[model samples]
Target: MSGRLRLSLQYKLFLAFVLIIIVPISVVTYVTTKRVSRQFQDHNRDLIRSIMEQMVRAYQRYGTSAVAKMEKASHSREIQEISARLSLTDSLGTTSIFEALTPEQITESAKQVGGPLDLDVFTILTGDGTIISSSHYPERFGYKNAKLLSIAARQEGVPFLIQEETANDTILTVQAIQRIALDSATKSLIIAGGYRLLRQDFLELILSYGKASLLFYDIPKKAITRLPPGRDGNPTPFAQSPDLLKLARQISEWPNNPLQPDSGAAARPELQAEISLGNSTYMFTGIPLIGVDGAGLGVLLIGLSQADLYRLLRKMTMSSTIAAAIGILSALLLSILFALRVTRPVKELSRAVRSVALGNLDQTIGVTSHDEIGMLGAAFNKMALDLKDNREKLIQIERVAAWREMARRLAHELKNPLFPIQVSVETMIKAEQRTSTEFSTIFAEGTQTILEEVESLKSIIKEFSEFARMPKPVFGPTSVNQVVKQTLLLFNPQLRTIRLIMDLDDHLPLIMADKDQLGRLIKNLVSNALEAMGEQGSLTVKTHLGSPKVPVGAGGTSSLASEGAAERASGRGIEELPALARETWVTLQIGDTGEGLSEEAKQRLFTPYYTTKPKGTGLGLAIVQSIVADHNGKISVDSAVGQGTTFEIELPISQPSLAGTETV
Candidate 1:
């Protein structure tokens, strides 16, 4: 298992993916939940604080209008008419002017000053409290001991906020109470009105921060408010958890220490904080209300439940998850495609190797890619090519080995009988052994024929033996022009009949070549040329140094230069040897206007034992090819049956040297 584990890139890649993204995501989830959520909560609280200040300013403005209306109505036309009709004595105080004008009349008159509302709008002075109006159903009119209202009436800059309660029952209402002067009277009246709980403006302030709901409560005063209760409109109560209630109470009493609590102090709650009310959780935040004299009046509360917070969180979470999934899937598909792209060259190399294993040495896998894997693929392709080349060399070597075996057999088979024939012919050539001049002539002919046959056998042995054991090249600098000249000079005895034309470049650079083998190469080409010419044609010997100047076709040589360094080194695996071959080449083209060879003959001309002539040993051009190849050169033939032949040989020209000893 461990060994298999060691070889997998997939496991390594997975580890990389985890390291790069998953671990970081874990960290982010922790920090965002721990640190960022609370910060968001703080931000929301600041917003609430700002809203509280705005509310204070708005209420202050509203208070001015309410106060002004009450003052003006005291001195208005209706009140003066009522006063005249009553005919009360001057300076009479504490008069009950109720029978003349009802509550409806007061509401009508109040509407003329402000906007319209409930019809039960009237003012009454009780023993210790005063009532301006009641939106609720209540009848206690003449006297009610209400020190809450009385204390708020005298000496105030802003209105006082107080909780409203029924005489015998606990009424959950918050009241905004204030004292106002009627017609500059030295005595003042306290006015109050409110509904049963937190107003619309405060609920709206809590709902604006994201989708969270906040609920606040007072532990001491036990004051609480829940907004937007549920889908159906109903108020939800605060939950039974002490910690939550405590936090809510703390929030409600903000800007004041609830335990000791500063005077005229208030505190607002943070946004995104959740509070449970009833069975459901609500989110909200609130602060304590302060009086105009910097005194702590009571705790102010606000917030909603938890259902909506989860809904918003799920929405955002789903969107981000889908986006992340799409990104990962795209990466997955791309990774598969890229892996295939990376592995294609390797697949080709594998196929090529299989082909080679099956003995098909001719298959080639082309180069691809530029990265490390691509480089490796290129190297594998090179190995395949080398394998193919070595296979071909082995086949060639085998063929040469088989030819040697055949030669050994043939030489052995004919040796004994040919020796007897020579002995008999030579004995007959002696005068005593001959019966007449005719016998002598016949004897001479027989001996000559036998000697010629023996010489042919010797030539056959020599050719195959030389081919079988081609000598290692002794590399040195040599001039190709001189080699060509010497080869032609070796045929100098026959130079009399053949029209020999020599054209050679003077400055052909020295090339690394085998001296004796190169000389033999030129000799064989000249011999083939002479043979093709028979006894009477022009033999043009041309020598030069250049790119593929050899009369062999330019097909393979040009590919060497164009295919670039690597292919040029291998010479494009061309069948015919290239003149310049692996480096600089000296070109020798020997043309003979003789009985030219056919296309078929040209193809097989350099092949060992493949001959067109009846008496020809067939090793002439074959040896030429072998020697030229041995020197890292090439040999080829071009011919027309009647037009004669051209033997093109390219040898790596080295320093010029004298010819070897002639075997006469």
Candidate 2:
């Protein structure tokens, strides 16, 4: 996970932006939701507490009022009259009334006393705490179940109040004990009355606080009974509201389930839990109901539904998720734009650098901005201009040097012939003074000498003129091997001293060329070979068709000045000549076995006015170069010291001539 974080600047920036936006949003959303939930919890606790306090006050107030009302009813005038009647019946006869009056009569007497009170139960008890007759429970006719009233009788004017639990119901009653004085003996009759706590009334109180109810665990029944349906709606059985029931059971059975009897607070019935009911959620708190005697009666389950809180939290989460998605997408788009804007200049600079490496110094980057990249581009442009200027200056220097060398060689050649002519003329002038006797012979010799030297000077001048004004070649089909054969024939006489070898391929193709130029090109190479051999070594001239796949190396001699001149005249550099000279070229190799040329000599071998032999015109190889150039051909020399020299010429097989004009 950490390794993935080590990404490029663009990605890192994107990640940074995402974290910056998303982290805060996530944290805020989470905190807000949690805080809201906590606050709801506090609010729920306060609400439940308020409801319980209301219930406690209502219970105390209602209970006190009920007890007071019951005491008033027990001492009512109607009750007193019924009491008087009971006293009269007893006074009639102690034994006779006891035998005649049935339990029904006792019940009638009690009802007549307490009937105006509209009580749920009315009963008569003897002074011995025996139930004589009951208004609601008539079956309790003879049971000694009036201990509550008997105790009241002992208290004189005080009435006894108690919550009586029976087999079928529980009721609250107030008993008024009155002593009846009689002739036979002292006797007492008690009137006890109260009302049942109906399930309907209890439920009404329970629902006064929001969807709440009372659960009473009947220990005898071993099951929880919902008192009744609350005011909100009909109460589903505890079996039906499983979520609520399960929690209620757990809380009710706390000490027995998860806590020991001595676990103190944990054993005490105060439970708070969240439950899911159907699709809605709720939070509830349970409180135990204790009697005045400090005995557990049942639990008072107080529930505050949490469905609204859950809905709020879910909505917040969804909103946060949506915000994060939008933020991430926007960040990604912005990062891409920023990255492109930042790297554009760098990419342009890189391209310029590549162009410079490839020797394209003229390539320039646009200085569109006043940033670092723009400054770098400006520097590069300045460097390219400087390089171009330096190259031109160097070419000029070499051109001037070549011209100076040509002038010096010309002067030296002309000086040689001119010096002899001057000396011969001077001798003639001196001879004329000597006498008529020897003047004729001296004059004749002088004239002959002058003519010969003049001829020599003319030859030198003519060679130079020819090199300067060399003619262009006229194209025609010509065999290179045939031309070599003819040139070799012309050198037949010199071949006797130097063995000649011809390795011309008979299958060699014809090439577009000038017959005379091709012959002259071959003749000069053969002549130089013969002369270099010093009349004893071998001279080999080989001709064959060159391979069309690979390019053959062919060019003028190593003299930059001469080669540059040739290229300029033809408007083609040595490297540019390949367009005219195709791969399907005719090759001619002319070699010689002799004291080979030094590297320096070979370098300038074909340069105009450069020659090694005395009395030799250097125009021969130069003329040959011009002729090959005119024919859209290339010429190159391969030679090593003591290993002789080989001159190879490659000409396109049948390219048309550039200049259509023919010159003889």
Candidate 3:
């Protein structure tokens, strides 16, 4: 689970989409389902009320017929005869005298009475409001029921009236009252009667209304009776719908005031609740059953199965799951495609970088798009081309340096014999012009000049040979400062007009170098300085040890870093230079207070056979550069027009031993 939770970008995005798309859908589905259930409850309540409304109307019609029958019975001839005899015997015309009637007499009289077939209650009441007898409850003879007496007393002169009453037996009924007049004498006796609400017809009427499971709760008795669904003869008993009945029972117990809708305040009955019974679900609700006079009799419970609702919700869930699956699948596929589209170019660029690392500067990638990746490819190609150009330049520079060395040697070799030959020929000519001059003297002088020129030729050849066959150096711990001091001592007398300044650091460390070669390098720089000063200017030679913490440029050693980097890149094998070059490097600077060189001359200052002076061979500085390079050192010149020139050289104290190293 933890591993799965470690999210990649694509999966994280997919989860985000799932939440965005599926969460709202799930919430909406749940809310909608709840709303639908509420609607079902409200609609069912309305339906049950509609059915109850019709049931009340049916009960009212039954009461009306019973009232009509009671009224007719009161007007019968037999009832009139009895009322006349009774009235003649009472002066006040008080019907309370009828209390003397026995229960057997009342039962016998009602047997002969003609009235409604379903008369639930037949009673005789006196004019002063006393129940003489009730055919249904004959044991209550001579008793007074205030509810019945009130109906009899309130019947002033009206022919008949109806009222609702509940007897001591808890039988709820609607009664009718009427007076029997004995032939217009204004004398009469009151008769009251009613039909009980517990009749089978009443229950049948409610059950016939709808398919809702019904239960009649007897409020007074605290008993429950299920009104079986369908017709009376239908064998399907009410118990078959136990789930519905169970739900109905539960709804009946909720807080309710059915008799007076607004009379009581408890928690309003739960409008709807789900109930499970025998593998099925049902929605339950309740309605109050009240008597005609607004007395709460019982509750009418109704149950509606929830099978259809579940089916609807299940279908919705399945559809949503499938849709979510499709959405996530689509997101995953698109994310994969997008990741590949972005990474493919990066991989190609990586390969190109590797090619460059392996010194293959010609490798380039195609710029397929105008995006950042394409821009990178274009930049890579430009870099490769630049490197290729720099390599070619370095190679050309090496060739020029080689050619310059060869020309310097050739010039030196040829110039030697020519001077002497010219002098010898001139001497012979002079001899001929003087007629007294001896022929032998002319031959001897001419030959001697020629021989001298031949020896000079040999010396020039030896110099060339020596340069070409330069001996190697023998390394040792030599003081560079001491070498510079010795070279200054040798040239101090020769430099008659030149003012010399020596700023050498006595604290410089010993370097592994050839003293003879070091002396030659310093002599060449000193000679050039004197010559550039035109026989009368200051010459400065400064020597110091470089600091490790100092950067190359700030310390006048940047020439080594830049040029060494180029040489290393060109495979010149300068990588063996000591890492302590910064701190252990011995720096020498030669400055001349004379006419400075132009930029072109500075660039070719160390090129053999290239000189700015009329009598200069140019090999002097060239030889100095070669000696410094052989010691694994760097040399550079800084010059500006009209300002003097300065030559700086840096040599390491220790370097890797070379094969041809030898000491003089």
Candidate 4:
């Protein structure tokens, strides 16, 4: 948790914008693409089903036209004459139509009628369903046409599909049967005619309507035949495509009573499936082809290529991705611009506040807008101006109060000396007037007392003048430990009866200070300590590098290095203080195990002309305070009534030049 990174306003804003813009766009693009792909697939399925329906309609029309042609051929003169002859009986009842006409004449007659009708097969059947004469297959003359016989018995003049088999192959045809009336003694004769339906031709016709593949399932042979585009050869077996095979099987298993031609069963529902062939995929619709008598002939599968639809979807997805990227980039750019615009004023305000904290109380910042930031800037400027004015007034009041105190203390000291001098001079005048023998002695003593008192007044005046005329510090790189060691030498003889402890850090860095002024400050503190200790207590002095005091918890203090202190100072997180301001300090502490001063005495310890000593002029600690302040340092004292006293001073390792000092 302590190692967590701090994010600035600009980056936070950028992230927010990215999530807000990109998330919805991504979601919408995904959903829309999916929906479009699904719709495209559905449309393709419908198209395949529509194509199959068109083929079925075409086949029905072909069947209807074929039936009409056969009906027209039934009434033709050649067919009528052949039927009339077939119905005619010989004089002897045992002779039939076959005996009445030669086989050549009978077949030739059927051909003459079938040629104009454009029929593939024209045949005359006996009452028992034997092919008496066939126009297309003369060799089938003796074969029985059982399908025709049953269809004739049910209903004649209606077209129905039939399969005629030969040694080489099988042929499918749409044929209509017609019965011609004869005498009661002679049985009725039947005529059958139809046009041949080649599977290849039918597939070709279906393909001509659209760009699709056709698979014909032969129910009898249990085989699926594939008719691809632009192939003129016979259809090949299509066993590799499992999807198409499944569709074929599903259609073939559809419930229907094929034997009941007139049962009026409901039409089968169209089935659609998708199959892949080679590198391309297709959508197939299975259409069941029904024979005329409602028999399950086979399933005709029509497939429409889905390559175009897939290609379109791919293009759409690519387009969507590119668009999303552009949108995100645009959002990023806008977010950056916005974040900079917003944070610029905040950064300026921060710098201004730092300047104010560093004692530049006249700091002012520009107000660019009427927004919250601008309002804050305006408030800060006002506060700075007010503070500067107030500080000037307060300084003036403090100066007057200090001068009043100085005058009162100086007057008090002057009164004490003036009284004695006045008394002595008066005594000397009386002695001279009396003209006694002891006049000389009295004069000598009075003169001596007067001189001594005069000297006392001069001494008090000199100390006051020195304190008032204190000079500004000449800052330079000076080692605090060296100065403490040098000053301690002056008090060595006086410290013979006292236990002296010195803890000076060797690694302490040099501080910017006046060497002479630092010597004086240390001398004053040591003098005070020796005076308070008198004869027996220990006097201790220490010099070391010091860090800022940081608050650890409630009512607790912890010391940390400059870097850590600066970071801790600004609770907003990382360090906000300038590097120079956060530099380390050198500390000097001097303590005495003497009768410590009371709290009131400690409070006014550095005040000028305040002293606890009977004959002391209290300017030493005050002078020390002034010197410390001149070097941009701080001083503090910790004391108890009887536990002793200690003075701690902290000075920066380096500092900017003093405002009115000459650098050495």
Best by TM-score: 4
| Number of the candidate with higher TM-score, 2 or 3 | 2
TM-score for all predictions?
0.40, 0.45, 0.44, 0.62
Arrange candidates by TM-score, descending. Answer: 4, 2, 3, 1
Residue-level lDDT tens digits of model 3 in 210-286: 44555555566555556552354222333334554454455455444333234442223345556665676765566
Identify the runs in model 1 with alpha carbons over 4 angstroms from their true place: 1-470, 493-507, 535-587, 593-595, 639-644, 650-664
Root-mean-square deviation (CA) per prediction = 18.1, 15.3, 15.1, 8.0
Q: Which stretches of candidate 4 lie over 4 Å from their true place?
A: 5-49, 76-213, 217-225, 228-233, 236-239, 247-276, 290-297, 314-555, 558-664
* Better TM-score candidate (1, 3): 3
Candidate number that wins on lDDT, 1 or 3: 3
Candidate 1 lDDT at 101 equals 48
Q: Name the lDDT value of residue 78 in candidate 1.
A: 50
Order the numbered candidates by lDDT, best leading: 4, 2, 3, 1
In candidate 2, position 306 carries an lDDT of 81
Candidate 4 has a TM-score of: 0.62
Model 1, position 558: C-alpha lDDT score: 17
How many pairs of residues collide in each model?
30, 0, 6, 0
Q: Candidate 3: how large is its RMSD?
A: 15.1
- The candidate maximizing lDDT is 4
558-641 per-residue lDDT for model 2 (tens digits): 322222223322323333434443346677888898777787887787777778887676879878877876665667777777
